[model samples]
Target chain A: MYALIKAEIFKLFRQGKTYYAIGALFSIEAIILLSAYFQGTNIIDLLLENLKQRFYFEGTLLNGNLLVYLILNTLWFHLPLILMIVVSGMLTAEYKDRTLQTIMLQPVSKWKFILSKYIVAIVFTLLVVLALALSSFGLSYFFFGKGDLVVYLNGLNFFDASDAYYRLRWSFVSGALSMVFFSVASLTIAILFKEAAKTWIVSAFFLILSNILLKVDFGDNWFNALFFAKLNDTWQYFFYYQINWEQIHFNSLLSIGYSLLFMGAGIYWFHRKDIG
Target chain B: MLFSQVLLGNVFAQPVDPDLLKLKSRLDSIQSFTTQLTLSVDISFINMPVKKAQMMYTKGQKVKFSSGDFVMLPKRGLDFSLNSLLEYDFITVDRGMEMQDGKNCKVINIIPTDKRADFSIATVWMDTRLRRLVASEINTKKDGSYTVHFQYNQDQKVLPDKVTVNFEIEKIRIPINFMGKDTDIDRKKMRAAGSKTGAIYLTMSNYQIKTLL
Candidate 1:
């Protein structure tokens, strides 16, 4: 298992797509930081237009914590899409190149072979998220400096610097879980399709469909809470003044269950897959 | 000072009432002063903890507010001197006596003679015994009406230790672009909550006054 995991990690690093994923995350961060620099004030002005008339605001609301949060919002679409493309390509590219057959020829356990891929995929997702966190925070603070964060959640939640940092840390933790699900699901899709281009299209469409479904209100709180797509946005719940630990915990556990379910399906399919 | 000039002159042609002059004179006595204050917002939609800020006020200049934390201050109410309210030429009519917050106070209605003034009219309830403004309602030309209630500690008669400012603010109709499942926003509720009559409570202490009469 250890050797198989080691080889998989080695393969991941050698893959050009992995480097592209890291580059994409940093490139997104740079664009966001620059956007936050020029247009962020206008956005803040619009958000506080009503309040600005009545009250004078002291201290900069557009700061490191706020920029990080804005960057974190990309988890809803961009981040996961990128994760899906890269992780799915990991499996599909192997199928295309016949590397899966070469690996199986080594007398490796089928469970370890596939599970190693799943573990590596999860690790890759976390690393991408971590790289995202580091770049977003480092650049935002370097450019915008430290101050309080004002968010338009539950009607204008203004958090001090310390509180904002705490919320941001947890948000990334939950956001990474959602991204892991995408990576696992994408790998499962590759296992099913056995083609890189076909897998990418299916995964992208799946993400968009899931996002669209996430917004469809069922009008029942229990139903809404239980919906798999709705669990994707669990990270955003932390910005609320009163944090909902139960919902976060439940959603986080549910996210893990969904990831494992996809991994299980991938393992099951890979176990029976016949090579030419 | 109310009724500063009758017609482009500095002095009023008629004798101004001493009571109205006393309110302005009481505030004008301090050359400048600084105080630490905690401001709490009481709007149903906005949620924030009390912010600690230092306010600096000079007689003829704009009030300056500074805080290490983010602070929201009512643009009109923080001017404790009532400088803006009484700056331009205005006439005071004795609206007679009224009981305000259980204190029998003299009601002075000030109608601004200068079109440049932000307020159309202001009604002040003066605590003649304490020689201070107990409460006042200022109707601005554009920013809506503001009602200020001042509470002074007996020991610190010059400045009110506490101030409650009530005003009507335009309801916030801005869309929240936040992402999350729990962020199911009811636009109907947001519309209902957008505009509201809110109050800002200011607790002032740690005074550093300079050059008092």
Candidate 2:
């Protein structure tokens, strides 16, 4: 497993496209940090100001919570695109570039070959998310000056930078795992359709479909909690400074379940499928 | 400062009248009263210009303020109301005395009970002679502070025609264009954002008081 994973990592690094994903995430975060520092005024400030007229704000904007928010906003809609760009080509490249035949001739089992690729993809996805979180923090801190964390959630306020950091770290962990599941799902779709165009379409189709499914409110709290639509909500529940874990534990568990299910299916389909 | 310019100090010269205490006690005993108040919100925290909103306030289980065609329900999200601005809860406590506008006045501090309630504190200056609120210093928890000078009418049922809101603001320098309803609008959002610079002065010319229980 270790050797195969190492080989997969080497192959990924050899390809120049992986670095582009990192570059894009940094570029986007830099632009947003610049905008936040220079925009002078915006909706969030207005909302907070309106509240301040009546209450006191406890923390500073330079903390991890705001950085987390910035990452989520920057990557929210564009994540699937990032996954498609960097991940869709993983196995498909070997197949398209006629390297799969060479790999098949090796003494290693096919399952190891596929599992190595999957492990590499997951690790790559984690690294990409960590890069995003770090970039957001670095850029915002560069411009805004590092201070204590401040977050406004569900109309309540909380302070203390240390606690905020843990919340942010856990949120990043959960969010990064969720993104891996999404990337794996995309990779699975990429494998199913050999043609790059068909792979892109299938990947995008499922991404949009999952997003749409979550938005459907059935007026049933239990049902909504069960659906993956509450992914963002689940992140908030887990990472919020003062979270009522008991109330939203079920939803957080559901998010974990969905992520694992998607990843498992991706590996299952990828290992069993035959190439032309 | 009930009658700051009045010729005689008779308002206070008659000695602290026992009746005056009764009147004050009467007003105080009415822990919360439902009344219609007309106000102007003066935003003075921007350099492009000073902005103001004229609103009518109604108090009951909730406090509603209506300005122009917009009503803001402050207690519940960023809701827009064309008819009234509602505050789900407001709490007032007597914060002792203060001298303002060159006269001695009792100060009452008002705070919103809702966690998301916006106004941080409102300090009202009441004139002992007039038995009415004379001036108010409204401090937003997040931004600048504004002072409203009130000139009450004799009827005690409505406010005077001329109301002034004084603002203290800080200047902010930015490098990009912000998109709003108007492309060329820079100060609108800062005014909305309460960017801690500039002052607003409000003057009301006409008086119309409609009484509703």
Candidate 3:
């Protein structure tokens, strides 16, 4: 498994395509950074004026919380697209290029090949997410300086030292896992489509559909159970400070359940599927 | 005891002829006084349970009232004092019914020209019955449909002494059990603690009223 994982990572990083994706990520981050540097200060001042009326967000003007907010705002929408691109290419690109036929000619199990692809996709997604997260933290620290990290949750603002750390740490972990599930879904869709164009369309379709489905409330518990409706809101449970822990744990388990079911079904389908 | 002194006290207390003249004269003598006062806002739309903030103002009519971050001009051409009902153009003579507090009470309806003005109409129950201006009820408009009652402290009317402004509005009900973190344990003890979220008492205590030359 380790050798297969390592080889998959090597194939991914060695490719010119991965570098192009990284370049795109850098360019996007730079544009956002410059935009925030110029406009974020004024927006932060306005937010402070409004917040002072309701919550006590005590600190110097440019605080850590403000920086964290800017990063989260920028990456929330963009990161998913990046994940789709990276994951779709991992398995489907080989199939598109007819390289999968050559790779299968070698002595390797179909299950191992699929597992390697999944693991590689997971690693790439994590790498990009963590890099962006860390870079955001660094840039925000550079510009705003460190102060108490305040977050607004449940009609209340949290500023306590311990709570902020707990929320950030848990959110990061849960967020990474959610993205992995998303990558698995993308990989599955990509494999189904032999052509690259179809792969992009399918991945994009699910991304949009997931977002739309999240908004529509299905009152029926039975139907709601079947759909991964609003997984982002489920992720928010970890980030929000005042959440009832027992209930939050239940939702977290539900999210993991969705992710696992998708991955399990994708693997089963791919194993049964003939390359012809 | 002198007849005049006894008569004067009765007149002031009952606000009959002599007492009425005295109260009006006292109000007229002070052309203008500048005072720093705190105004607390309690509105239903505020969303929060309690909203308390302090505002300092220099009031005059033409009333140039400036608080820390806001400046508003009250309509009726501005030389108005909430202290004197007549000064605010809220006074009228009801000859049929005698004024209760005594000098000679009037039944007058005051319409504020300022559209943004907080209260819709102030129907003053005035009396020249005392040393200063007497009793009054300032009914304010709420949400264009509901009326909020603000009853003033009639007995205590002077600068520096706090006047209690009583009010009652629609009751705000929120769930008792908090879903989030356990910041406060005592919150668990209560079944559901309900209070008037819309009612706020503005107590104006100290006034730095200054007269301009």
Evaluate every candidate with DockQ and list the scores. 0.64, 0.04, 0.04
> Model 3, which residues run further than 4 Å from truth?
A41-62, A74-76, A147-162, A238-241, B1-213
Worst window of 10 by summed lDDT in candidate 2 chain A: A150-159
For candidate 3, what is the interface RMSD?
11.9
Interface RMSD, candidates in the order listed: 2.2, 15.4, 11.9
What would the per-residue lDDT of candidate 2 be over residues A154-187, giving only the tens digit for each residue? Answer: 2223333455566666666666756776777777
RMSD of each: 2.4, 15.9, 10.8
lDDT of 3: 0.53
Candidate closest to the true structure, highest DockQ? 1
Q: What is the C-alpha lDDT of each candidate?
A: 0.84, 0.54, 0.53
Clashing pairs in 1: B171-B194, B171-B195, B172-B194
Span of 10 residues, lowest total lDDT, candidate 3 chain A: A50-59
lDDT of 1 at B186: 55
Q: For model 2, how does the per-residue alpha-carbon lDDT over B77-101 read when each residue is reduced to its tens digit?
A: 1111100111324445676778887
lDDT of 1 at A47: 79
Residues B1-213 of candidate 3: C-alpha lDDT, one tens digit per residue = 234324222222222233433444444444555544343334332222121233233432333343322211112211224432233222223343345434455444545444555555655434433354334445445422222222335554433233223333332222332222222223332224322333323344344444334
**Pairing residues by index, what is the TM-score of model 3?**
0.57
Question: Per-residue CA lDDT of candidate 3, range A123-226, in tens?
Answer: 88888778867776677667656544433333334333344445655665666766776787888887678576788788877877876676576766866645
